[model samples]
Target: MLSSWFRVIRVKFLLASVIAVCLGLAINWWQNQTIDLVYAGLTFVGVIALHASVDLLNDYWDFKRGIDTKTKRTKFSGGTGVLPEGLLQPNEVYRAGLIFLIIGSSVGGYFIFEKGITIAVILAFAIISIYFYSTKIVNSGLGEIFVAIKGSMIVLGTFFVQTSHITMEPIFGGIVVGVLSSLVLFVNSFPDFDADKAGGRKTLVIMLGKKKASNAVWIFPIIVYGIIVSGIVLHVLPILSLITLFT
Candidate 1:
């Protein structure tokens, strides 16, 4: 029973959560230990919860939007539309999503209350921004940029949470991981573009023409990573902190 329930938690999505935690670990390491195990673990759980909500919310919204209609069977996802799969009830999915969302929000609220404005303000913006990024509001119109931005925030938030200040290190690391993360979002969209367009999903790809979108799929990451590596080489990231590369 436990193993069966475990399937509901997507491994790939969990790996992404691991990456976020690793980012926090890296930042904590960079700052020479401003965060200890308890705080870091809690914060990592918060990050995982955010990623979980994103997966669940995205699936629920897509199901509602007809993007994952009968013709569309499965998506590369954490939720995987289990309701559609007949493996779980709709209400069950909702409950799971809500549970994760509440836990995630509670953790974030703790950080806000304890750490004050810097992390709190940014997290508030991130929540609002990402929520809209999946729904009709910001999701369709400014898809690429929004995805890129969320990717960047993993690094940004990690840096600030540890040091309580923003610095060039996070900026550079943000761009690197940000572009990689954005690339993941961009490419994953490709498999779904047809269904999305069929379902009247007006994503950036649908709006700008898939041709441009395809170019962007390639161009955006390269350019962003190029800048990041260059910054590292030019000593913009501080040579002493080069240990960041391995972590």
Candidate 2:
């Protein structure tokens, strides 16, 4: 049952949020020449909690809308199979999601008190985005845009909490993660194209059609590499940051 809860939270996929937070920390250290382990640790936990909330809530919404029932489950794209399999009641997932969201928000609230209203703004927007993402954003054809902003904000917020100010490095790093994360959402939407359409939802896949949207996948990597190379060329980033290209 504990393991089932892990699966419900999609713990493995939570790495994306972890990576974004780490990227922010990396930039903070690179600029400030110091690290705040306690703050960074708390930020990581808060970010992951928020991420789990999004996953659980998404599962709840998808099942409610009947999208999960129609889409063929895959190792990569489909919703976690727990709800459809009857491993947990729908309300259980919904409550769990809310619990996680509250935990994450409390952490953010602490940061806002410690730091300033800037953190408050970021946290407020993030919480709002997570709540609306599955229901409203995905249906409005702005799903990809919302996701991209979500990833970018995670980096920015994490960095701001540490430094109490924003900078170009985190912005650049945020853009890289933003585009890549959106690419993940974009690609995943393909399998759900028919499911989304029938349910009155419109993802990037539904907006562009499959063939054209598939080509957009390559654009993400290109933009990521372009930012890295350009930042290096302009001396905006350290030479070592180039190594990220291989990854």
Candidate 3:
């Protein structure tokens, strides 16, 4: 039962949020040399909750729309096979998604109270976009954009919560993490191109066609490396950050 829930939550993918938060913390520590461990831990829990919400909600909707039924399942692309296998009920998943969303939002609410309107705005955007991501955002072809922005905000929000201010360091770091996050979605879309199209979803893969999309894959790495190199050149990111390129 626990494993089934974990599968639906896509626990492995939650690592993206972890990386985003860590990037924000790393940037803050680089600049300020201090961190609020309590806030940091809370941020991780909140972000993970929201990430789980989005994945769970995505699975629910995909199954509901018959999209999951059409796509050939893969480790990366297709929806979790939980529903199709009757391991869980649709309403149960939907409720769990809402619960996670509320848990995440509660954490965000606490931050907003502590950090002011900045956290408020970020929380609002996250809640609204996350709830509608599969039903509307994906259908409108803005899924990739939303994902990029979400990742960026996680970094930015984490930094703001700790430092009570914004900086180019977090901004640039956020973009690198955000773009890399979107790349995951972009690549996954490739395998689901046919089902996504049939289900009235318009992903980057569908918009560009598989052939063009394949060629376009190079753009993601380029953006990530460009930002990293530029940040190092500008001295915004530490020289040690260059080690990321080796990965």
Candidate 4:
């Protein structure tokens, strides 16, 4: 039962949001040389809760739409098989998703109280987009874009909460993280192309067709490298960041 809950939350994929928050904090430390431990911890809890909410909700919606039923589940692409296997009831998953969403939003509310309108706006965007991501946004063929923006904002929001200001460092760092996240979603979409299309979901892979989408895979890495190189050249990011290129 515990393991089923973990699978429903997609614990491993939560790492993307973790990295995003860490990137923001790292950039804040680089620029300000300080961090508020309390705020940082709250930020992590909030982001992770929100991430879990989205994943749980995604599984619920996918199951509802019969997307999961049609797909060949794999480690990387298909939705978690928890629902199909009846490991958990649909209502239980839906409630868990909402509970996590509320927890995340409560944390954001605290930050907004401390930080002001900026945090409020970012939190608002996150809540709305997260709720609709598995439905409206993905169906519109904007899933990748939404993910990239979500990653970038997580970085921006974390930096803002810590430093009380914005800068080019977090912006560049956010873009890199955002693009990397979108790349994951873009690649994962391929195996789900048929399932997604049948469910009336329009992903980039479906929009482009597999062959063109295959060729387009190079774009994500290129954008990431381009930003890193540009940031270094412009003196916006530290030279040590170059080590990321090796990855």
| Candidate whose lDDT is highest | 4
Backbone clashes in each candidate structure, one number apiece?
Answer: 0, 0, 0, 0
In model 1, the Cα lDDT at residue 219 comes to: 82
How would you encode candidate 1's per-residue C-alpha lDDT over 170-209 as one tens digit per residue? 7776666666666666666666777777766676666767
**TM-score per candidate, in order?**
0.83, 0.96, 0.97, 0.98
Model 2 segments more than 4 A misplaced? none
Which window of ten consecutive residues has the lowest lDDT sum in model 1? 70-79
**Better candidate by lDDT, 2 or 4:** 4
What's the ranking of the predictions by TM-score, best on top? 4, 3, 2, 1
| CA lDDT scores, all candidates in order | 0.65, 0.90, 0.94, 0.95
Please tell me which model should have the higher lDDT, number 1 or number 4. Answer: 4
Q: Model 4 over residues 44-160: C-alpha lDDT tens digits? A: 999999999999999999999999999998898899999999999999999999999999999999999999999999999999998999999999989999999999999999999
lDDT of 3: 0.94
User: What is the per-residue lDDT of model 2 for residues 44-159, given as tens digits with 9 covering 90 to 100?
Assistant: 98999999999999999999999888898887777988999999999999999999999999999999999999988889988998999889988899988888888999999989
How much lDDT does candidate 1 score?
Answer: 0.65
Check candidate 4 and list the clashing pairs. none
